[model samples]
Target: DGPLARLRDRNQLDRADKARNFALAQAGEKYRECFFRAGLDPLRTLDPSQEVKSAFSPNGLWRCESQIENLQKFRAAREAIPEDFREPLAAIVLEDREIVDVGREIGAYKDAKMAGAVALFILRRGLTALARHYRLISPTGAV
Candidate 1:
């Protein structure tokens, strides 16, 4: 059997012995557990054929894919909003503006909660419009 298969067997044995104590609920914890279960080998590659010293590791590939997905989501979000509203929302996200500050900038709402609600409503509407534009959703709002 391969090293990975052996490791998997060992992990399963350990888990059986531990009665699920090794299991984690959170995603980050689960990833860490996977690494630990793999015996914490720095030189190990998911693809055994790849060199241990390869610049593009499995983690790097996963990160690259995650970044692309995030960029796509950002683009979709930007395209959803009006041109004028873009700058303000960008400032809120990038500059870490406070709820009160956002409220002040967005006018007509005295309450911070109300302002936040309004912003959320706008964001939802924009996303829905974008969904319609992409034809992922129908006019009756069936996705």
Candidate 2:
């Protein structure tokens, strides 16, 4: 990898440049700032453009359900968790987990800014953890 390597790096960076553009009407500056303050970089990659929002979101409350359930299995009784704490995990979650496979996943999508940025950010950062968490509840790519 010589100067040619720099060219390769450029090719890779180009996609992320495109990905940032994909974040949409809603995933605006506030979401970006929130994520950034929380430690996830908004411009990590291109958007996935999945265009799918679930009633049970992946961020906070969804996590709470599984976390609470796991606790029950670990102990005879599971303590009731606060709904507030369970919310989307949001930027707070980023501080706990860093990017895992940034080069491939985060560097690869094309979608809404907030969702895509968060997806790439989460995939790059919390993917392994998310995968591990997913494994406990469902299959690997369920989320």
In model 1, pairs of residues that clash are: none
Clash number for candidate 2: 20
Let me know the TM-score candidate 2 reaches against the reference structure: 0.17
After superposing candidate 1, which stretches have Cα over 4 Å from the reference? 1-80, 88-101
Q: What is the lDDT of candidate 2?
A: 0.29
How do all models score by TM-score? 0.34, 0.17
For candidate 2, lDDT tens digit of each residue in 1-143? Answer: 32212322444212443332222101222232333433223343311122213432454332344434433332211011122322222322323322222223333533344444444333222322332332321334222
The best candidate by TM-score is 1
Maximum-lDDT candidate: 1
For model 2, where is the 10-residue window of minimal lDDT?
74-83
Give per-residue CA lDDT, model 1, range 17-100, as digits (tens).
Answer: 332212211111322233334332334334222323335455444344453454455455456556655544433333335434
